[model samples]
Target: MSDPSEMSNVRILGDFRGDPSPSTLRLALAQVLPSDAESRPSAPDQSTAGKEDDSDGAELAMQKLRLYAQTAASQGADVICFPEYFLTGAMHSSWKAVRERQEPVAAHPNPEEDESHWLAQVAAIARESDIDIVAGTVVELGAHHIPHRKDAQHKTGGPGSASKESSDSAVASKTGLRLRTKDSSDLLFNTAYYITRKGEIAAKYTKRNLWHPERSVLSPGHPSSHPSPRLFNIETRRGLRLKASMLICWDLAMPEAFRELLQPSDSRDGPLDGPDVVFVPTCWYATDAGVKGLRWNRAGEAAVLDSLSMARALETESIIAMCNIAGPNWPNGGDAHSFQINDNTKDEDLPIVGVGHSSVHAPFLGCVGKVEDGNEALLLAEIDTKLLADARDTYRVRYDLADAV
Candidate 1:
């Protein structure tokens, strides 16, 4: 375990309430390429693959995560964030197709234990790397567990799927996997977990707004059932504590959600009333099925992303850092023609490519740093609390709203 004190006794730079003496937090966004195994056009069948094969997929993902986390730490980043559904290579249609195949039911016999096992691995990575990690969302198997990827090990026809209760019990005894949540029915959730350098799970936020495709395989998170007020604090190396929160891909399209977070709370600390920074882990794609007569829709989806991200930052007076998955041919070079648009092309002909443009946007400053195009890249930005204070002072949007209400 990493030292908890490393993140403690740090300076608490004030926000909105003033007292900002130029505190900055180094934020790193990993615009990562999907693992070659999972990025393949076709998906692997974990149902038929043995234990070693299953472990291979999980191990490969962890390896990449460690590599990215280490790079971010070396680059002096206080926190490193990965893109959504990054663990399971969400772009490939096969994962979604397989997950939707099963009727809503507990994907794992012991959903809590299974979920923890994977979460622990992520926490271990954070501890070992000694960097705060906003692990990209993963498919959680629980009551309402929707079976996807790793859950395929528990597919009806698989060996382990047979006599699940007995088999899982034996495995649990051998591994000493402890149970946490009691409800085990069925529904898949796209959940994100925040881990401190000390390997402590500081917060978990389930994606509340499901994208069109996700609705078929995933369930939206309801605050009534889960925890309320999805927010947390980050202790940066520069001695600044930032109020932060998480949102998944499609949630960016919902302005009301961002507005809700900006609403004043009952807390005495004014800064705690709203987030100083909002981190969005996304797997947003480049192409969309265009609607007739809508020029914006016909052009591309990138503009929408750019507009919403900037608006969210400016309106809420908070920094918005979005980490999106990279294009198909990322890191290494790819053909330029892959990005070219053909107006005459049919909707089916358009490739499913991540729009990239992983970026950090702040009030007034706009995009402080960004990947720029559909390619693998790392975006690092210094989030200054003074910016937040300045925005609030100049705009007075929060003040106006409070007084009006």
Candidate 2:
């Protein structure tokens, strides 16, 4: 059993002028991946392969998510977040395979229409568990028809150039666009959905920054002509409102995305308090030998992930909950050490990865609660709304930025 004293403290904020007591939100990070063995159909089912296999994989993934969510809820987690692409597993080895497995967003801008959809099932679990859920990223087929590469390799050169094949033929052949005029379309996006405690869809954020290989199959959320807001506002059951922002895996590597969410807006109507929490769902890969030298002798990928999360949290003065996928089947599988950053701590002070470390960070306190790597587990932490507010009040980073702007 865990000791009660080790649990993070939740302080109440605001004056006691008949205001409701401060609510402590128990946030849970689910760091587990879908089992590849379970996803595979039995030997008897191999006769009808392809589509059946994809559907089976989707179903299995959802089951895993629901089970974990129930566990978190039972442990009294108010909000739970899974890793990026937890719904569909990692990217496949082929673009064609990816396109074939992509699921269409039910009735665009109106996901509630289909109650039996995978995403709806996710919401149902949240509602049943009485917890808000950041259900991770799913491959959403959009309404546009864009040309994509036939192979899954990342492009090394400029646009229209292929690293493994001839430029002219590869570009011309792969760029062939089969126009789709139907209202329901076939464009693909890496999308994450936020489900309220009531099991209602709150917001959906598409990946704006695509990793090199992902560019071959997925489209960016904000194209040149169309724009959308990545940040969202979430209100807890006790009326503790938090300005929340979502960022997919590779998006964290780009500082601009965080800046946009953290920086005060030009309009007077913009949030005066700025974002309180940033949720990052990632499937970051392990660094290769070449990159290890630049990152020092520490755990390459894990170090980078921890550093980025901490840096972002300190710079923005907000709590960061970063959940990552873990399993032996993953590429560089054990390297997926998820971390939360609230401040700087000695590298040696952190625990080494047994499976992968998942944690929650509080403003100025580095790690408030954490689960070391190895087994699948739920990391729960109590985030005090008042403490967060007090930190912002003292730092005044948001106020200073607003004034400077």
Candidate 3:
């Protein structure tokens, strides 16, 4: 059994609260790459377009990420958070194709061995730096040889389709594997995975809600039957079940989504059972973070972000941390190109439409971190975990929750 004192004092970090206690948490934002983006494309398809050159881009991105991680470590952050896909791109298709090959539900992770190697590298980075990492959604390849990957041994990533050959092997091998939500042939899961200090996946959260196009790529999490505000909890080796949970970018738009997440995972009766913090991971397709005022879909507007975040905070009273891609996350796969302010322009230089960027929203004040770059950027901060106490004070909030219950 782990000691009770180990998880009490969590040093929160991320880009959520504006004007955080600058000296308290020592927050550092990760300015990592979103995808294979060329700051200055040498005119047209004259660039390295295939998968081989992309490996080079991946290396460069990893290098930049290492530097950023080290920078944050040097600044004294006990925990560091990165935008979605700090190493690879946010879109799941790339991982699906690169790591595996599948058609719809039955696709197998072609490059099955790679995902573990990649995860090991990131875990090593976190361990060496003595920092905890909230790795952006990374695809996990299922081990089952069939079309899908599933079972207790492989939870979130499951089996897709049982191959005749693989099924025959399963029968001969006597490996009793039953599939649910996923199958064997390296199933792909859209998960916001939080790795603990021990470098193991503390908790794996398949996104509860899926956005347009993503529905085609990922599975939507079935809501946990618990009806409280706390969504998930990660008990540290020391026995501290930190109220850790994840909400993807598009899910932010649905206020009802928070309801499922708000329920506590702990069996305890104290306040500690409730999550003190929540992370919103996003790949902003609307605005260019580095390019300021420009947005891909002006209709998304600050109002939308504000409404989405504010409602959750006030109702849930949980500190929110949002990390978004700041630079040219072109195409759904970066097949197209867009720019942001950090490239060499000002926020006022571009039009406000079709140029949405990533931002962090806190309970008290919103818009803590805004990235105008076309890559990954961290909006690290420290939030007053106690802020949730205020939610009960809101007469409307109390009434609604009470009524709902």
Candidate 4:
């Protein structure tokens, strides 16, 4: 119930911004559930098709999230974050399939009429649990000007299709639909929402960086012509004020995205400092061939993901909480019991599913706490705001790099 705006009393001392009052925040990261089939309710009608299945999947996901939120709150977590696309599993299928599964954004005219009431339920859960919640990323459809590709029609045949003559026919046959160039009209975005303990939406961050496959479907938040980065200032119930920002999975790979949030902009009135903590809701995956070209024989891709998390925390001099999916690839058929939390299995013997290594990294201490590899569980870490203040004084990275291009 604390007013976030009233808590913004950061003082400007010489060249640096300082906060005299500092407090610790207990953070929790919830990995994706093992399987929906276990908790999913029986279908109303066996003949129900695509759209009905989508609805059922969304409902099941929400049910699991509610359970996680309740558990995190019971464990004394001040704020809990879910993995990216936790609601609809947007990246599990093709773009067209995602569009069918995604719920419509609440309209200003008559918000109650929207097909999915998932947002409202999320807010209610936050309020009931008395915990701040980052409700992962959602696929948002908005109108934007997208230029048409010159050979879009020809390229639609297939990845290796050379002949342009049968391009249209091949595309229709492969997808069971006609291929058409997208006009300068509507586009989709991967957007994350920050809900306060008061059950209100504090901020919304649209993903700026799109992964390779995502580029073909989703639009960038900061396109070439327009640039708008979002940040949030949250005041915890315990009277702790922290500057916070959000970055999707791929956004963590781009340093410039973090730089944009840390630096003060011309539009701001006073000197701006970097975020105290960065919440990353990711679905990062590593294959058998390893990430990029190099493979670290023993650690494999999970090590690569951890290295990125550590490097980002060290470079930014801030706390980083990375929440990732913890099960086998949903689209690809694989072991159903991979991410299950079994009491009989030893820690080392757990199945390595989706290379899950959800962790929390501190500016000074590299890895504060992390979930064991291949385990599906909540990773909690206590982040001291005073440590961040102390780290800035020792490193002076922000102050030294403030004027650098």
Candidate 5:
């Protein structure tokens, strides 16, 4: 279990926060299967009674999750992956519902207050469990922020970015700005972050393809003007470079986005230019009940992305993991309402269930070991470092056109 952590010069995490925690999260790399315990694929919570409660409810949930995280950690898992917003369901739900509205959703206690505690908890979990973690994103920026615009870079804003004196949130410090996903008018970057097991920020990325109203809340991706802007290059703890990236919930529906991640023509110049793997961490809520799992909506986009990503992973010898939210939407309603700004879904029964098939794809794109079923889980698969080395050496993959003869 600790072998990976100890051997890991750097660890990359892909958190799938199913709902919201508002507390601490202890994720495990992978849990060893017990002979006696039947492998019951985890799914969403059927009961929605606890939807209204906060604080204590959050604590109770954490206690249950602690047991789950401990199971994986004690088993020897090193890097634990979880869903997005793994801390607070209440905030996430309210935010999703109220985000597009004139009124911004506010967490009772404090917005920034949520993630710090969770971050501290994760750090403590790592120290105690001897494991590294990827805790999901939290809605902590209701206050103290700016835009990417030069004038707004250092400018301060009140609460949300609503003032004429407010700054743009696009210009990031050293990591650079997020890719604008929506039209030029919209400006919210669907941000994704990479954290080292040591709890340091390795890299940060944002969703390039906005899903609709989600587009309204996001700006276009960083490389939107370029040939493609849809991948995050991660430095794995194994010293083996992993180009694990994300394309939020709706981005999965964009063919161009996933296609760009697999192909290296723009950056390098051709196929096999490294970045064999792509990661999509999402808030995917399913509408159809018959579907085995929740997939990115927009026709069969999720499956399409899966097929395309798998094909590219095999073609380029990379990996693609889609870590999505698990568990049903507390009350199990919504799908009929549009994101207000103007985006609407064709289907209305979309379940808020954040089910995940957190599995690893081999060089040939075949799945390795098992996959994660429920919302809150850390599914680990051995991403062969040697294989990546062989591919990189066998073919110059960093940048196709850049390294092209």
Candidate 6:
């Protein structure tokens, strides 16, 4: 799967990690199916027993993560990214339930010393594999980082902004997870962590746009709280420097999210105007297309994913790396009814099927590499910065929007 032209630049010093290319980043998208035992809701257990089960589940998930990270590294990946909520699985539990089962981010005093903590374990795996990792997301409890702002507009701007008042109290109230004020000492968050090759916590991004279903369990990140951009920079094994950012599922549907990352900011410190690559970790399902009676058909959401990723790539003039959870059936023609979850259900069950189309997109090239089916697979691609430069030169998207942003 190596790009011959890009591979030619490799010095072939020895192993994959040693043969670095200054301009090409070997990106690996790990499309993994979470352990069903971990993702599924367990029967109510006694407090002591539940704690043991939770510990076991975390260990099991970490085993898979370490294995995959190693596998990706062996295959010459400078960076490997997983899907959203891949660590904790899409529990879809209530806030109270989540707070009870998961450790608060504040509670972890020393992630390095606490091997039981997911972040600590993932960080270790990054160091072991000697690869940078965008470790999907984990559901956790944490204090509100942004204080409540009454005049905060409650709205985000961009071409893909959700116009239907997604953050409106009335809408959020439907899930019963809405806070009276944005500030709270205790709250659940769907947080994504970025770990460097040395296992440093380079950056962390809490998802800003909550999927309708997620609103019931997690809080969205503050739109305007932090003046600086949520971004990080990485130098690959080949010395290809990349500026990147992370977004969770549903955020991809909002073009405004992309704009917020791509738009140049005088207050920012990263390279270029913004991120050269955007990593999206998602748990999106095939049944999450539209409201009942509104969807074109059962398979319509597949088109939504493909269209949105492409649109984001073309419009932003950058690389979009998307990795989604993989699951059994449906996208492979398994009956939708035979599988379980639906959007409107209150059961909060793990999705038995996913629209796993893990892919990488360049500005003009569209999808450079993709996993066509919803199955466990590692999608690798040679991301050449030259293509990004060429796309910007031809489109002049940056030039036109220079003054607008």
In terms of TM-score, the best-performing candidate is: 6
Q: Which stretches of candidate 3 lie over 4 Å from their true place?
A: 1-28, 38-53, 91-93, 99-116, 143-187, 221-242, 264-273, 287-303, 329-357, 372-376, 391-403
Q: Mark the 10 consecutive residues where model 4 has the least summed lDDT.
A: 8-17
RMSD of each: 11.6, 9.8, 11.9, 10.4, 12.6, 8.2
Off by over 4 Å in 2: 1-21, 35-52, 93-98, 101-109, 145-186, 223-227, 263-273, 287-298, 329-355
Residues 1-405 of candidate 4 have per-residue lDDT tens digits of: 223332232111111113323487888888774333233222211212233345566777776677777766765677888887777554324234555544434233232223346678888888888889998787765554232333254344456866764764564343332233454233667787888888887777777676655655666664432233456788887789888888888888888877777776463433347788899988765442222222224345677778889888877788888888765442235443233334453433332336668888988888887765544677667766788878878877776666563
Model 5 per-residue lDDT tens digits across residues 58-108 = 454444334444445554444555444444442223223223421222232
- Candidate 6 lDDT, tens digit per residue, 44-135? 11112222245566567677677767767777888888898676756554234566766566777667568776677788888888999999
- List per-prediction Cα lDDT, in the order shown: 0.65, 0.61, 0.49, 0.63, 0.42, 0.69
Backbone clashes, each candidate: 8, 4, 72, 0, 52, 1
Ordered by lDDT, highest first, the candidates read 6, 1, 4, 2, 3, 5
Quote each prediction's TM-score: 0.72, 0.71, 0.61, 0.71, 0.54, 0.78
Candidate maximizing lDDT: 6
- Per-residue lDDT for 19 in model 6? 52
- Number of residue pairs clashing in candidate 5, backbone atoms closer than 3 angstroms, sequence gap of 3 or more or interchain: 52
Candidate 1 backbone collisions, by pair: 105-186, 143-185, 144-186, 144-187, 145-186, 145-187, 146-187, 146-188
Candidate 2 lDDT over 125-169, as tens digits, reads: 878877899998877666643333432332347776565445433
- What is candidate 5's CA lDDT for residue 108? 27
- Which structure is stronger by TM-score: 1 or 3? 1
Worst 10 residues of 6 by lDDT: 43-52
After the best TM-score superposition of candidate 4, give how far the Cα of residue 43 lies from its true spot, in angstroms: 26
